[model samples]
Target: MGSTKHDGDVIILTGASSGIGEVTAWELAKRGYRLVLAARRADDLGQLAGAITQRGGLALPVPTDICVEAQLERLVQMTLDHFGRIDVLINNAGVAKAQDAATPTNPHIDMILGTNLIAPMRLTRAVLSHMIPRRSGHIVNVGSVASYISAPGQAVYNASKHGMRAWNDTLRREMKPLGIKVSLVSPGFIRTPMTETVRGMPMVGPETVARIIAKVITHPQREVITPMAYKFLIALTTAFPGPSDAVMSAWRVWKW
Candidate 1:
């Protein structure tokens, strides 16, 4: 779990087409880690892979819809086929919709939970079959501050992230003795294409997250909240839920 040399380590990364995943892929590749990139956008995934290969890094793009169990299985199989082993799995694919809890369509709700929560759990299970026998691997889940702080308009997103946080924590404990490390990297609002329309919140670039992920791969931890300041916010909110809820409610109305 803690190694400085990643010369030929195989890392399977979901959501590798853009944002945090793409950035993290490049960061890991720079550290000499062979990468198996998974994402629904084939063109983008291929392009990213090509770019990495051009830069003299080992990368394989496996276009995948992580929501589908068959696709997730295929992804794991392909990684094993090409790399012959899986060293790490970064579950980064996620989707979100800012809508009232009752107003959002069923498909939207399914998409949010399926991509953010269910898929990661399923994919991790598939990868574990291989990792457990080897007694070595790492699973880093990309979560959000929404997991700890709830906002009115983002009910579904909040739920999905909260579920992810729970899963990550429980899995970390379970994997500790198995020699498989599990970590959760929760970031505040980030400046990604996904958050282009988001406003009035401090945001960090995807590179900041990418670097943290690379570091976590080398030195695993239970959970990390980036920008450091959010740690204080989470502590404050946890201590005073009523005031926090009132502030979030006001912010939701302001956005409206």
Candidate 2:
């Protein structure tokens, strides 16, 4: 059944306190999906949940640190206990510790890899068993343009996203026969707290991404690149890595 057949299509969204995740929650809630919001900030999660509830929807805030395996386990258990089954898992929680790779300590590496890569793997594993038996579910992995185009000061972040895309691709093929759909939503830079310091770059708003994500949930696809323009950029960069690298190198030195 399509996601629109929602009287209680339970969805668990991570990184839901702000940015794309936040807006996506509103979009899905308005469409009748029951939400289980997870994030590190309890106050923000509660506020967003309250706002959704005020809008005459079902949203339960489960303040969670996705980096913590125990917390992630608790989150899935809570959602299942409350909603009975998870129709969708939106792995939106991600972190970017952009700096020169040489200076990264173990903690920095762990933090980036843990939140951006390991967390999703674990969360997906937790929900896989549930979705597999039913043989019907969706997993949306939110990635970035960096997954295709690499640049300076984003070595770890780039690695994490590339890893996400790899996992999403493999899982997509593996789960196709089981009726499980996996989608990777890769977007160019978005105007969010995470990218506030990135000036002079074209950035789409979070809602733009949320809309694409909402559409993908209903009409599932293997992958989606928002704004449609990034698809060309990604194609060019992938086809001509040498020239792409040179151009990106020059971009790092360009004066704003």
Candidate 3:
């Protein structure tokens, strides 16, 4: 897959209206990849597509609530209808809410897991219907450091990301034999609206992650942790759970 040429490749990008997805859309479009943008915000999605088209890039905005199974199907159908083929699927749409796991209502649990975990799984299955037949495509799941380190006050979010990481690893093996590449781009704290209120961590702009996603599409690695430093943190935490637990306790005190 590394040697595969990407000229005029059609990529479906979810959560394109903001954050990493928004920046990634621009990055991929600049690299000459045809894009199908999907998000719940119709106006923002349309504006983004229009902006890309104005700059001589191919973009089709498909407003979709990824949580809805039907909309996920429609998004893929629309992309195939417009572009004739889907070369890449970037599952970037996600949501997080900081609250006590015991206090969260069922809706809260559903929203977090639905958007961050289940939606991607279902969307990937929908896209695979097409990619499997061609035996040529790439699936990039945007995950979080939370997948590895479960911080305080974010239990459900941590669970969602953890599930995502597991899914990505197994899916990569399953798709490998079929010639479809699966990659996970996990990042530490990022300077997006999603993390604006977060503190006590070094943060990078979403563009940094966006560039990595674009590169992964061509180079194709199994998993990539951005900023590189987080890889060491994840290793240390996994090796010494007691210290990680103490730090998480301190974070809980400081946060709440």
Candidate 4:
């Protein structure tokens, strides 16, 4: 039922210019999703949209900076104006800085929290008014394995992801009664521009993560952690917090 319904579904995807979001747009387009691509890079967004359209998929590029309140509001409004109804909202825009919290720059903290956590929450709120009335919608949050496994030098990044995970979990339970599906995709290391300096990690390609995200939208689930191996790691860390902390602490690559 869910799968069939997702065909030709109207979706708004943030951070659609590159990385996981860009690949996810391609994956969803192939699966028959009509996309509204949002990102700060207008040129990249336009090219991606044009390519999707050339392939007989529907897409519109709306340049957006999710951290800005006005931009986010306009993004939701534009989606509603263009598509009339939005079936899914892919909250994929995020930023990460591998630095210690001890430095404590206001702009850095704001950028991380605003883009990764606050923007998604605000966008979801803006979209929910329309979705709740219709009794149908899906919110798919692209999170990180860092949501579960805390790493050094990623204090702000970890906090944002952990908040995203909590929000997704709570929204899933709340929206169940409203007939809305909330899903979270927590991927481990993925090869992207943001992770270019991260070497020798167990990384999956963006396309793989995108495919999983597409599947999650069609067949809704509460959460999914990519690469599968991370699932066991999550369990191990959860059951033995002290040893897990010790291991992560000793891992020099993850240190600042």
Clash pairs for candidate 1: none
Candidate 1 lDDT, 171-247, residue by residue in tens: 99999999999999999888888888877888889999999999898888888899789999999999999999889
In order, what lDDT does every prediction score?
0.90, 0.89, 0.91, 0.89
Q: Please, what is the TM-score per model?
A: 0.96, 0.95, 0.96, 0.95
For lDDT, candidate 2 versus 3, the one ahead is: 3
RMSD of each: 2.4, 2.5, 2.6, 2.3
Q: Candidate 1: which stretches are off by over 4 Å?
A: 1-4, 253-256
Which residue window of length 10 is worst by lDDT in model 4?
1-10
User: Can you rank all candidates by lDDT, best first?
Assistant: 3, 1, 4, 2
Clashes of 4: 0
